[model samples]
Target: MRLAELQGWIVNILRRGSVLAAGGLMGAALAAPQAAQANLHQRYRHVVRIHERLGGIASPAASGPLAPGIDWIVMDAATGRILSEHNAYNERFPASLTKLMTLDLAFHALSHGRLNANTPLPVSPAAASVQPVKLNLVAGQTVTVMQAMLGMTTLSANDAATALGQYLGGGSIRRVAAEMTARAHALGMERSEFRNPSGLPNPNQVTDAYDMAILARHLLLDYPQYRYLFSVPSFRFEGRTIPNIDGMLKRYNGAIGMKTGYTDLARFNLVTAAVRNGHMLIGVEMHAPSWIVAYNRMTQLLDAGFAAESGAPTTVIATATSPQPRAAMPPPPVRQPAAAPVLVASRSRTAPVHMIVARSVGHVTRDMIPGWTAQVGAYDSYILAKRQALTIRGERKVGIARVGSAVVHRHRIWRAQIAGLDHNDANLVCSAMRRAHQSCFIIPPSNESLAMR
Candidate 1:
């Protein structure tokens, strides 16, 4: 079967609850030993073509059942105070989020005058042949340091990132990866290891939420001047406008840019930073089941972190009218044998590195299956209702807050509710809100009033 047919067949089988069969067929058809082995060196590519065809609109989840690993954390970017976390130190694949370290090295090189933004770097055959979500860089062509970085930030281009690695490594990608890992260690990412520059599906390459959060904080703090590159929504590459894959940049109100990563093994990973009311928050999530879940949960984490930090109800609310992000669907990864653990250690630097710990706000995890909603209050405007819901959600640190409308007496009114909670969760949240003298009521799974946006 063709790639498209293979994708469709996998989806159909998965929907029918035959994950094992799909995996079996996929292994037989696509995971041939030779090809799989070759891919280990080529790395993978982003599905940029499909992403463009969809006009940057995120389609519904298409990857099979959710990938198993789930790790996340949210923290104050400036103060290093972790608001919440779960399994923050567990090792998981970092995928293309590895480019953040690559970019870190790039920024460091630029700062020390070791590399110039306009410096010409030659692309190798190795860089040109990596998988999709790429710029299709030709081996003989040369891309400037800025162009390569832009390609990485916007398209998550494997070719661009590889070429960057080769340049920084003096024509060696492995050397650059070692340097990346070394820098990560200096920044206090002890549990992480970097085997490749582009987070292709290397079994040995790994990291955790805590390590990623620390890396993100360093990127923001260490390279304030180059931070604008992360926020570049799109860039002109070879006459094509390549958009950033991190949809939160357009979907969430205060979202700045960080990075997004995925692979069959790694699932969906994201590190997001945003500024609201002058406070910057950094969030990291790993191995989310799908792209939609990854973005939604990241937004929830950031919202809750902001709400907790503000020490008051949040006034800003993200409405449905905000730009809907178009999702990119990469072709499924070929299965590979699990990799053995590889330990990585970096030489210590003189610069002091402080580790940030979670501030004990109870385990803050996404209510991935919210079966009940607690209605806080409704207001004249949708924004007001959403604001109230967000405030309550942050204050309570539970459920996904959202706004839906109702037509009452022929006049449309908005409803503010926190969804993604079960029966006991709903009751507990409502009781807490009631204790605080706030209006609180529970809407059952079948409640007509719980029309979420």
Candidate 2:
């Protein structure tokens, strides 16, 4: 149905304000699969954006032009067709969206009889040591698989996720993360990788918005029995009822449950699913400048998704990079150049997530550009990254190094970098830093730096 065809909705559209106006283009894409409408070969595929003046003021989009690298995708649960998307394939830091895989792994364990709901996951020192935005499970405390999942989903508890990862990894967090990444690839998440179960700021951990959407679809299709885990209003843990971190469950009509996350580097990330008129749709938004903006915008997109499905019933197609073959459904249309850039008024009042932690370390290589860089910390300010570099050099009292800022997602953050060092020297620096009880990753000049927007 075209704009006039959606007669009843026109009234609602006028009443909804700029949100629906901005999000309307997506609704057109979502209008479901019509043999004549979805033209994959066209220069302009499903892109629809409106940039005209409103309320006698230039829209925020005129000034901002849609913050770079923000990715979003919506898919029909019944049909795998990706109804709408932008920057959907670009790799990004997933933040807490990583927990969906943790949930998948745990659910896999349950289904395979390798672990039962009653299985005990004792908190390791590592799990306890993870920073706050955690459940605060003390070291040696034991929690059941169910308890941990509740914490992982509702509280977005880092400790619980880490504890579960440690348990499932056979005492090796790295091993479990590798296994999760493998499973994700097998399930058709081609551009995704994982470093930690909890989505702490690790540059090695990366996934595109489309990959997350595939994961969401699998969660809905693969484990319908466990759908309650994602949408539950609240769950009890350690004698407290922890409300879900997903705000849409209460605020947005038909909002079910999904995941949410934020880090200065990952920025705010979200994956949401909702149902209306018996149709289900999932929304994935990454690298939003603010939580409020991300949530509101997603709700608007989901409304479009539901409206689209209502216009026509969806047909099954591959969602995201799924390897599954769809002989009947046609390939997705080529992206139409957007008529207007997507933009939002981000209220940056909330402090950015502090992802970097500077600590005691030991290493030295003075007055020489070594060739390779070993990064230990990340900051929102270039000055802070440089200051941390100076402090590290001052502590070592023998090495010359400098700090640089890199773009992680849309957020411009500082990296505590020591550039111009050889591989061996970088290794030795990292080895010494690790021994000094710090974390480090060697960065080569040719390395795919996460700083690039």
Best by TM-score: 2
Instruction: Give residue 406's lDDT in candidate 1 (0 to 100).
Output: 69
> Per-residue alpha-carbon lDDT of model 2 for 303-421, expressed as tens digits?
77776666744442333433332323423321211221111112121322111112224221221121356776788876667676767654543223455565657887767755444
TM-score of every model?
Answer: 0.56, 0.57
Give the top-scoring candidate (lDDT).
Answer: 1
Q: Following a full C-alpha superposition, what root-mean-square deviation does model 2 have from the true structure?
A: 19.1
- Against the true structure, what is every candidate's RMSD? 20.4, 19.1
Stretches of model 2 off by over 4 angstroms after superposition: 1-69, 312-453
The runs of at least 3 residues in candidate 1 whose Cα sits more than 4 Å from the true structure, single-residue gaps closed, are: 1-69, 313-453
Compared with the true structure, all predictions reach lDDT values of: 0.67, 0.64
